[model samples]
Target: MILEAAMLHVKEGMEGEFEAAFRKASHIISSMKGYIDHECHKCIEAEGKYLLLVKWETLEDHTVGFRQSQKYQEWKRLLHHFYDPFPTVEHFKKVAKG
Candidate 1:
């Protein structure tokens, strides 16, 4: 499995807006091929920040399949503006688990 992580820094006072946008955007991603699951968590220590964790079968499923799909365009349109500084996404493979 591939894990994608992003630390989203939403604009001040736009947490609700960001969540609403993410709700819509997530649907687009979830409908795509190779999508496993995802979770979004609001940061209690840092207001307006969120952590997005997504699981995929492979990195290509995200970097190529999902991002190149038409839904990604809509996802970007809906959610891109909410970020003050764009988040960096990272991919990881499970090293160990209990």
Candidate 2:
């Protein structure tokens, strides 16, 4: 499986808006092929910071398939404006698990 993580830096007062938009956007990604699951967590120590975690069957499913799909356009439209500097997404493969 592929694990994708993004550290989102939301605008000062737009954190709530970002969370709401992400909830709606999550539905779109969850319906795609090869999607395993996802979760969003907020940082208690840092305001306006969030973590987006997603699991996929393969990297291509996330990088190519999802990015190339029309759903991504909608995803961007819904959530892109909330970011301040924009999140940098990175994907990794499991090495060891307990």
The residue-level lDDT of candidate 2 at 60 comes to 96
Tens-digit per-residue lDDT, 1-98, candidate 2:
99999999999999888888898898999999999999999999999999999999999999998999999999999999988889999999989989
> Which stretches of candidate 2 lie above 4 Å from their native place?
none
Error of 1 at 27 (Å): 1.0
Give the per-residue lDDT of model 1 (tens digit) for 17-78: 88988987888889889999999999999999999999999999999999898888998999
- On lDDT, the leading prediction is 2
User: By summed lDDT, which 10 consecutive residues of candidate 1 come out lowest?
Assistant: 20-29
Q: Clashes per prediction?
A: 0, 0
